[model samples]
Target: LFSAVVAPFLLASIPMLQPDLQRATLNALLQISAQLPVNQTSAGISVTYPPEDAWLTSRWPLVINMLWSLALVIGLVTAVFAMLVKRWLLAFQQKRDNTLPDDVDGFREQSVGLRKWGVNLIVGLLPLCLHFAIAVFLIGLIPFTWHVSKALGVLVSTLVSVGVFLYGLAALLGHMVVSCPYTAP
Candidate 1:
């Protein structure tokens, strides 16, 4: 009963794992910055200053810090979400076994359907959702690369973000495959 009622709710909440929309917005800003010209000085004593690029030539430390922080937060959030899902499933199984009537075949059927549906939905959605997230994070790299100092930080953040997303996806897939009903020969 608990898995039937709660798994869908939990799965629907996966998008909330990425609570900070600021990361996507920052990525958009960086993408826009990539279109502008680089800062350069003309030959001779003359000096030239182009209009400050909104995306490039900004305080990179701040940007890098923000990106790394967002990645870390996202990773933690995903880990928590996975843990909660596992706990919920375990608790539901225990409760169902304890409380279900011995003759209630209909209840068993319904529980099987709910579990199958929830796992199927998660397996179908995980890849699409994480792929979009990774694309957004990668977009933030455009402006970060313009500065040598921020480049390393950006790379680290990007790798961590991608790694966490992949990890979560793998977990979801594993759950689906492992919990799938088996057929007898």
Candidate 2:
């Protein structure tokens, strides 16, 4: 029973972690770059690439690839979640319609339920709002930190934002489902 209640919250944290992970990767790459050697030639500057077998092994490129992978994962998961939620909502609405009697009282009852759902929806939106605020703060932090640290902060911030968004969305959908209108003949 405890697990059931906590499970959703835990799952919701995944999106929040996304930003942190991204920042960490970015910071790591920047830190690696800071160690690289650069020289000025007569025509231009030359920088020796790290050997293929080096531990840093194309750090920036690798980080870039990882970032792309993360983006793809986020997109795919969001799409799947949206599709499932849409189907579930449609099914729920249909069920409500079938259960309700075609009368004024039924309409009134459904309206009341809708009002309650609306309240829940608003409450659910709080997390999303908080997420946005945090993101804004993180953006502000970018200029204050060293290049590598700024990247890390950005990654952390992004994860937190995504987590909050996912959690808020799921909570809103759950509330809507539970508070959906149904009436008796």
Candidate 3:
């Protein structure tokens, strides 16, 4: 009953809508929108940007792009490595089961682990390489730092280098701890 009355009222009012009321409502909406935000698309969609921080807009995208590319490369490499590992595992299993000849290598495997090859190849090699690279690059800066301020620079550089090394070592240890549960071929 409520819907029947309200639906007819809405239909009748829509056809007989007052132009003055429509103009006033539109004007109010325009005023509100004008005060809302400057950033928007042509279709009146709102866009947002970092406020009060021009530095973040410039540097964040660069760092994000660098990390994205690194991750992409690492993922591709890991996928390939996983494929190889799957093949090796299949060949190893087949040889053990007497289906594959003992003289053939792992690369000659006909049936690799098709269902979960990607998961099985958890090499944990990329993070290790990145950590070591970061440690080496930071530690290698000690000589340049030594020239800037004799004692303070050397001390700071030494501390930073040691911290980076320990961080990398910890990361390596963590990787090994995680990976030790899974056996490799």
Candidate 4:
């Protein structure tokens, strides 16, 4: 269920990897900068490339790529984790039946019994993990919006910030209120 919710977000961010719009903008800037008059020192050496070009061609793309890569990794890992948890639960349920042999019952006892491990804790934390993956994807999306329009970028950044803050506050409150079911991931 959590993986299903995160799939759309993950899919939405996949196109950011290409970032054609941003590349075109940077290419245009580079062309303009190339046309600008060159700067020469008394030593007779010409410096044609602007410092901004170095940043646009290198650092800006690096930041965007790194963020997207991280988000992708987090989303994939969380999805795999959810699958593992589902499999574990299913295996436990199948092994729970009395039709299994005595030896198999001993195996189940060692592995899947209610008191043998922190299965309950793992189940409780799945939602929190899902939220974390989604947050990462949202955060990585900011630069893409910025590339489109500064105002849109600001709007998205503000909204994402507020949403993250609210999630944190809720998690903190859940911890503080003993009766609350939500706890830290």
Candidate 5:
């Protein structure tokens, strides 16, 4: 979240602070202070970005876009993965609890149970693993996704990978807590 919001704000604010990049703007507070005396109001000073040197017109916009887009994609992927893990866990629990009829032949009953487990395992795993793989794949492709500074690309990708990995580990821990029963020693 910080990387998505604060990082872009940093890009916009840091450059503005640099003397070399200073652009002229009408100070609204100053205008208000002056107007307070006579009620002669300048409709709050508007500090509009020039059409030529607008913030979005610059490379910073692309960089910021890339940063936030990566953050959003990774975030959504993490949610999907956590859900998948939870689904798989629930299926396993269900299979474990299911009981066959006493009158049914053991061989046929065993085969049926095995088939059910197999279907559940495949159903639960396919989407989970596919989404995870795509996320990892896109993280690698981010740099090539746009033309941006190599350093920024590499930096964002590294940060994203680390963040995603830690998020996944946390999800795994959460799965463990939910799937396993607590037993006092």
Candidate 6:
């Protein structure tokens, strides 16, 4: 269910995970310091310079793409894990027509053991993958926001930091508290 909701978002983000070639070209062209004024007047013309292009030249794109790639892989792995577990459970639930004398207790124990392992593994890892993917996406988003707007970048970075911090706190609490209901990987 969670994968159904998140898969679309992860897939949709594929096109946006690329570096901006136009921006990169413009940054390259703007590297020259020497330039003539576009307009001249007897009173002297004023020229405005754009903000530093360091962000474009830096490795932010590579870092962002790498993070997105990791998130995508994690999402795919989680989806596959979910499907495998579901199939296994369904197989276990299927009726068997064996008429030979069988030990009910042994069959029950085997079934229960397999079911417990599958359920525990899925429960423990699904949320962990989701949280990790979100964190990676948010981390990648900081550089993207920075490219769009510095104020927005700051806002996003702060919010993401807070979110990650809270997630870490929750995980720690879950580990420390025996009665905690939250699942942690």
Order of candidate numbers by lDDT, starting with the best: 6, 4, 5, 1, 3, 2
Best by TM-score: 6
Quote the positional error of residue 13 for candidate 2 in Å. 29
- Indicate whether candidate 1 or candidate 3 has the larger TM-score: 1
Looking at model 1, residue 69 earns an lDDT score of 44
**Per-residue lDDT of candidate 1, residues 1-185 (tens digit):** 22233234334433333334665566666666654545555332333334444433345435544443444444445445566666766765776777658847756765786577685465445445444434434444444444435777677667767876776777676666877443211
Query: Which 10-residue window of candidate 2 scores lowest in summed lDDT?
Result: 49-58
lDDT against the true structure, per candidate, is: 0.51, 0.48, 0.48, 0.66, 0.52, 0.68
**What are the TM-scores, per candidate, against the unseen true structure?**
0.35, 0.30, 0.29, 0.59, 0.30, 0.62
TM-score quality measure for candidate 4: 0.59
lDDT of 2 by residue, 1-185 (tens): 32233234335433433444555666677667656645454443344443332312324333433333443344444445556656655765775687647666765665577566664464445344444433443343332222337677677667766865776677667666777343111
The parts of candidate 2 lying over 4 Å away from their true place are 1-57, 102-185
In angstroms, give how far residue 34 of model 6 lies from its true place: 12
Candidate 3 structure quality by residue, lDDT tens digits, 1-185: 22232333234323222244655566677667756756665445443422433432234334433443444444455456657766766765666577545535543433344334543335456345444434333343343345345896669777996786666676567677875443322
lDDT score at residue 42, model 2, on the 0-100 scale: 43
Give the range where candidate 4 is weakest over 10 consecutive residues by summed lDDT.
Answer: 41-50
Residue 113 lDDT in candidate 1? 66
Writing each residue's lDDT as its tens digit, candidate 6 over 89-133 gives: 676555332322476765676568786676867756776887787
Query: Per-residue lDDT tens digits of candidate 5, residues 56-153?
Result: 34555455445445554655565566677577667655654564445346545555775776755655564565455445445434543333467777
Better of 2 and 3 by TM-score: 2
* Higher-lDDT candidate of 1 and 3: 1
RMSD of each: 14.3, 16.0, 20.6, 6.9, 13.4, 6.5
- Is candidate 2 or 4 superior in lDDT? 4
Backbone clash pairs in model 4 (N, Cα, C under 3 Å; residues 3+ apart or in different chains), count? 0
**Can you tell me which runs of candidate 3 are displaced by over 4 Å?**
1-53, 99-185
* Candidate 6 TM-score, C-alpha based: 0.62
